[model samples]
Target: MITRRGFMKVLGGGLVSAVALGSYAFGIEPLARLRVARYALTPPGWSPGLKLRLVALADVHACEPWMSARRIASICERANDLGGDVTVLLGDYASGMNLVTRYVHSSEWSKALATLRAPLGVHAIMGNHDWWEDRTAQKSGGGDTFGHRALAGVGIQVYGNRAVRLEKSGFPFWLAGLEDQLALLPGRKWKRAWMGGLDDLDGTLAQVTDEAPVILLAHEPDIFPKVPSRVALTLSGHTHGGQVRFAGHSPVVPSRFGDRYAYGHIVEGDRNLIVSGGLGCSIAPIRFGVPPEIVVVDLG
Candidate 1:
């Protein structure tokens, strides 16, 4: 038998603990931290007459109870606030990996994506996760292949080792998009990666004939070495910038090259690479040192 006074004491403690946890879960204390980075790139071919803002969002391992549509909408709302001329979703948006099937179904993605917008246009590509999760239905081509189609239906252009030029004020800016490198098996390739992982800058740039400043959108930033000197800027986000850095630059990362290239802007030679912190969680549904991100780049 328990005493009434003792029961009250235990109940009070439990209530306090529950309140603390509820606050964390509601983001009142922010269980995760998201940081937005600003970058500037000026290539020799860049048009002096044109200056534009490009917003890049990547690695949204969106699922339920975490990166829900409302949360995703909030992220986009932030991008529009940046006043970007164009918005680019750098892939990994619909990662149907792990046990996420329980939380999200294929049909729900299109609605979640409805929140995104770009004055010029929103462009996209598939990520390694999509490949890993889609193999079960690639050939049958049912709901899985529809991922690309859904994005396309929403006015987002999907590119593979191809370049799209956005013309403004008589100056054209080249935006190059590519497939996931991991999607390439020993016999398969990133299509563009046949040039050399994502690093083959010369091959990527060769497709752009105009002197227009070039911006490469490769999902993984570690490929910075292969980017051509001609490329003034490159955007990637595979590392998620550690997404959970413990101390000085997370000692362990999933990249084959290690954590050396985890996050932030990396400059190789004259070109610059910005690795987004990424949104959503992978492997698990929690983030520590890292928070989801939306990046803004000023071409000025």
Candidate 2:
């Protein structure tokens, strides 16, 4: 049997540890540690003279208590300071989870986004949460342009199942962005479904020249499997790096392929996929081991 003094000591230690952990989760983890995940990719054509710098920010849920307008602006400013040739914003503009949705006007978030600048340009693509958030707002007679219009308002051109050539003076490469796979679904629920009908990969790729290496922007990494080998690299962010990776394992990743494509760089043959840990949280406003990050990919 344990003595009264021993029990009291144990209880005090547990309480202190709990408080410390809670502080880290609610404060330190979510707000701090903006990491720059840099990668160097050598495309098919070996050109030592040409280099491209692409910066990606994913899942910026942009809701209160964690993601505020000032914080968004700061993120943009910091990203600009990184001196990326081109910046890509992977969506999740308005925040929500499960059946509960929170409304933060797109203009508020857009105001901060206008600050982002890159020489090649700032491009964007929608995530499942962006689609769900807009649909949720539409049910209440709000506008359906929260994600799309907001980015466009800030001089960011949004690509939906389309391809564009980078205007930089170098070995030309194509950037293709797919429409949100959940766009066809009728409701706010996000699940793995056969999205072949919704995505027009052939049409998107039609614009690209054969010689150029293709870099695809997709919200969910689950789409990586179907992506052809023609695409040299695919950039994505939707799982939030499992949002709670522990001991190098994330217990609750929303991937059908398990941890294979859950987060970070995944290489299959010559094709590659890089999944960002993302900038904000969903469902719960707390994060454990995974911190928000900006991914910088250097391709030549």
Candidate 3:
């Protein structure tokens, strides 16, 4: 009784409607909760006895309702489930400190973050957004007001160009964190007189011990070349690893320029740099080919 052309039109319309709704709900509204791990890299010559897992979470702009307290809590629960040796928050904890009250005010995010307990210790380093002069007066590698206190309040050992050593089965390794390379502002000095130009990686390594494998953390992956040979593994989460890599190619990363240092694990000489695609959105909200990630590295 129905005309074939009319029926086809109706079917087409129905499919279009469904796609529209799905896009708005899933992509725009974030109607689905996604949990994924982009295991970065394992340290070469890793000790069989040492089992260190580092979870790197980065670049959660939280500029809009895309991220809420419930979402933050959900992310934390997911991180806890990963079960790692160290949980490292790479930075950009908030869109800005002012929104801290607009979104989560009760320290629930902090408390939920602390729930992520690690033996080697829960460590974090400042991100550019977290330590701007307008945000916090600290230079690169320094902790800002919201980022420093909130993470520390939750028992995360936030660092400013500092290192912490951990021993497993008598095998020692160092975790060194530097201030955000992107956070470098002109005319301000970093604390401890430690942070210098990107070329000063040799100087940075001077303070780090070569007696053991060194794991370096710099917010931007571009600074990979500056890192030293003693650093067997490095964890970074800036550029969001192109935030949307596609077609066997990533978006133009504003940070790293070299061929080997764009995204994922890069073996530069003796150093292995694992750049996490990272969690959360930044600058823009569209993520077509790239999904947010949690980087899990196995030390064993």
Candidate 4:
């Protein structure tokens, strides 16, 4: 029923659109685009008197030609300019993809991150890539990953299943960080029915001594369901907004919950979670609708 000329025109249009999309996803969005996503919320149980602004950066999978040290420093500069009361690094400082001209070393990336500044100081937590990329930590199954040491070396406090009490203008709150939930990879030497995780949500929450509202920093959003009402807000970055999202849906989320916690602000039963789209690629160098971002959360 179709004419040859009409069919050829349709095919040509399709090819052109595909080429444009490919260029934007693989080159423009991944390499050039950086955005600051701002969110303001007053979570239930949060003190009316206390106001906090948090700048969060995550998944800086640093590597050559993509996330170089220079690029990271630029990002840090922008983050510092935001004038947040606190800054949090949500992890995955190591290069996650193998298509790098050269791997940016921990020292290089950490040095760049050292430029980040906040009145309450910069705090960090490790992500799965930070754990899985370290051969020494992976083999031993229970030691500080290279990413952890590098962050510490730069004077950034890295929390591992720990809670810290912090105050802003005489209002106190608790900040808790859980270890990576996907620390150990499966291998012949160590076989497990379930992927090993180092996170201790129960133990970490137990450390919070008082009723001061708690803000939990988890690398992956998979821990959201278990998060109790005790936590005012949960911040995470690991799914990378499924790396290619459209119409508020990410088709291939890395999470066990599928698209439920794929990205952005999600509220459920008085509990709140904000997942960052993050700054770098994961398994592949591609980004589409979900461009790299630095998330700014304003909580009261």
The lDDT for every candidate, in the order shown, is: 0.69, 0.79, 0.66, 0.95
Q: Over all chains combined, what TM-score does candidate 4 have?
A: 0.98
| Candidate 1 local lDDT, 1-300, one digit each (tens) | 889999999999999998775555345312245567888766556678788888988887767666766667777788778888888877776653464544554456656665667767888766666554665433332233455776776666876677878876666888888666665322233223232222234565678987778888888766677677777788887777665576648665768777767887777667788888788767765455666778998885
lDDT of 4: 0.95
Task: Per model, state how many residue pairs clash.
Answer: 4, 0, 1, 0
Off by over 4 Å in 1: 1-34, 96-101, 136-144, 184-204
- In model 1, the Cα lDDT at residue 26 comes to 44
For model 3, give the RMSD to the true fold: 5.7
Candidate 4 lDDT over 71-186, as tens digits, reads 99999999999989999999999999998899999999999999999999999999999988887787888779999999999999999999999999999999999999999988
lDDT string, candidate 3, 133-191, tens digits: 33345433433557677778767897767777777668888888877675644543444
Predicted model with the maximum lDDT: 4
lDDT of 2 by residue, 1-300 (tens): 999999999999999999999888878888776788888887554245667898999988877767878888999998998889989987777775432334456888888888889988888988777766555543442234478888887788898888998756756778899877655444345343443224567788887876677889988888887888888888999889988888767888877877777788888877788999999888887788888888898876
User: Which ranges in model 3 have alpha carbons more than 4 Å from their true place?
Assistant: 1-33, 38-48, 96-108, 136-143, 184-204, 256-260
Report per-prediction Cα RMSD to one decimal. Answer: 6.6, 3.7, 5.7, 1.1
Preferred candidate (lDDT higher): 1 or 4: 4
Q: Which candidate comes out best when scored by TM-score?
A: 4
